[model samples]
Target: MNKYSVDKLPRDIRIEIAHKHRKLRKQRGLSQTELAERSGVSLGSLKRFETKGQVSLESLLKLVFVLGRLSDFESILKPDENLKHIEKLFDSKRKS
Candidate 1:
């Protein structure tokens, strides 16, 4: 496994990612409370994620599907460092 860290990410990019996540969530008409209920993520955790851009993949997947942009998410949420690894793994396993 390749280890990667967010330590090299610029502050602006981090902020942009958080903002984008929050914007998408809001565009789907979900209050943090509602999103938390539907996505099984805590309201506090969602709030922190909106501000920090650091949440578990499972929580993010739930939110993305609820936000009506699962396709966009399938592309955008692949952080650069993990892109090649994911591509290789998926290429090896045919999608049903």
Candidate 2:
């Protein structure tokens, strides 16, 4: 999906991206269903996006939270190289 591809992103970045999504949802004070209704996303898909990091079209739509200043969900979706570096440090420490 990215220029480098999803696989190129570090795992920590993936987790961070997932975490940011959850945080944004919570900040908006909307239940999964409410968010879905407003965003035109499905509840089940929303739940999966929150817990599993697997986003559906509906899940992507509910990111608007103008009332809560919780916008920019898309900006945080990108992968980070720092995550890969952190993971490598952990792996080396484990091996040691």
Candidate 3:
């Protein structure tokens, strides 16, 4: 359960990510239009994401790639030693 009286975790995270994107954009000295062009994401998408903190994954990926943060996903959903430890949990859930 969430601790806050007004909890909106997904929105909070989205806003944080949006702020990071904006900070990175400024640090790299690129305007919104320039980032959109270099990332191949539509300018409209960029504007909406910055203003509303919402974006499609495809659009986010394009921006992240252009910003050189794609490696941040290196450990996501990877099945290796950690997966082996919890393999039985996965099987049990699947069987039920």
Candidate 4:
């Protein structure tokens, strides 16, 4: 199997992301309570996310904003380079 195949499971990805977020929070010396207060997310939501990787997008964004890692999400769902090239080709064909 290819390396990318291992990441096909959303559950795995969510767990990995949660682990990374927890590590970053610890590295920054912020406890869960402190982070929740600063990010305006409920402590219950934060705990759920840390333990189960379940969080709403808005809450996750708020948490990341407080952690200064919101920019990491900027590239998600971006158009692929190959898709852009194909779109350009189609545009040129349509203009002909």
Candidate 5:
């Protein structure tokens, strides 16, 4: 596996995501307390996530939903368009 594979870089990715979330929260003019109240997430969880990149999926979803960016998560785990096309081609060949 490559030294920079996804499995090897989860920590980095999480930190980056935390940074982006913090930036967006500030851009939206929401303090941590305000966001936590609006999103139904605990202020502790939000602070931990912002400072340490540690948060549960449900809490993260609630935060993003309150930030108006929940739709961005919909594409996660979906097949890539190019991969889908390649799979379709293989399926057609196998059925022939």
Candidate 6:
């Protein structure tokens, strides 16, 4: 089993992400209500996110920004290294 990738897990990814968020919140010593207030998200939304891993984009964004993890998403859609190498070859062919 790959230790770094969660792709093989049977658990829902949303639940896993929410668990990470919940852990981060606790590590930062923030309560759900306090996180809601600080992040400008509703308490109910925060609770739902932590408990059931359900959240709207706006609420999730607010929470992510408040958590100072906005930059963590920068590589979400970044090309893989092998894809990048192939793209380099493709670009050279196009430029020829």
Regions of candidate 2 where Cα sits further than 4 Å from its true position:
1-11, 61-96
Each prediction's whole-model lDDT (CA): 0.76, 0.65, 0.87, 0.93, 0.94, 0.87
Clashes of each: 0, 0, 0, 0, 0, 0
Off by over 4 Å in 3: 1-8, 78-86, 89-96
Clashes of 4: 0
Candidate 6 lDDT over residue span 8-63, tens digit each? 55337788889999999999889999999998999999999898889997899899
What tens digits encode model 4's per-residue C-alpha lDDT throughout 1-96?
246675457887888889999999999999999999999999999999999999999999999999999999999999776688788899999999
Cα displacement (angstroms), candidate 1, residue 86, comes to 16
TM-score, prediction 3:
0.75
TM-score of each: 0.60, 0.50, 0.75, 0.80, 0.77, 0.70
Question: What TM-score would you give candidate 1 relative to the actual structure?
Answer: 0.60
Give, for candidate 4, the lowest lDDT window spanning 10 residues.
Answer: 1-10
Candidate 4: C-alpha RMSD to true structure equals 3.5
State the lDDT at 59 in candidate 5.
98
Cα lDDT tens digits for candidate 1, 1-96: 113764555555656867988887777777899988988888887888798877776887787777876677556646576478878788889854
Model 6 stretches with alpha carbons more than 4 Å out: 1-11, 79-96
**Runs of candidate 4 exceeding 4 Å displacement:** 1-7, 84-96
The better-scoring model by lDDT among 5 and 6 is: 5
Please give the lDDT score at residue 48 for candidate 6.
92
What is the per-residue lDDT of model 3 for residues 1-96, given as tens digits with 9 covering 90 to 100?
257666668788888889998998889898999999999999999999998898998899889888888888678777676666588888989999
16: Cα error in model 5, Å: 0.3
Residue 50's lDDT in candidate 4: 93
Best by TM-score: 4
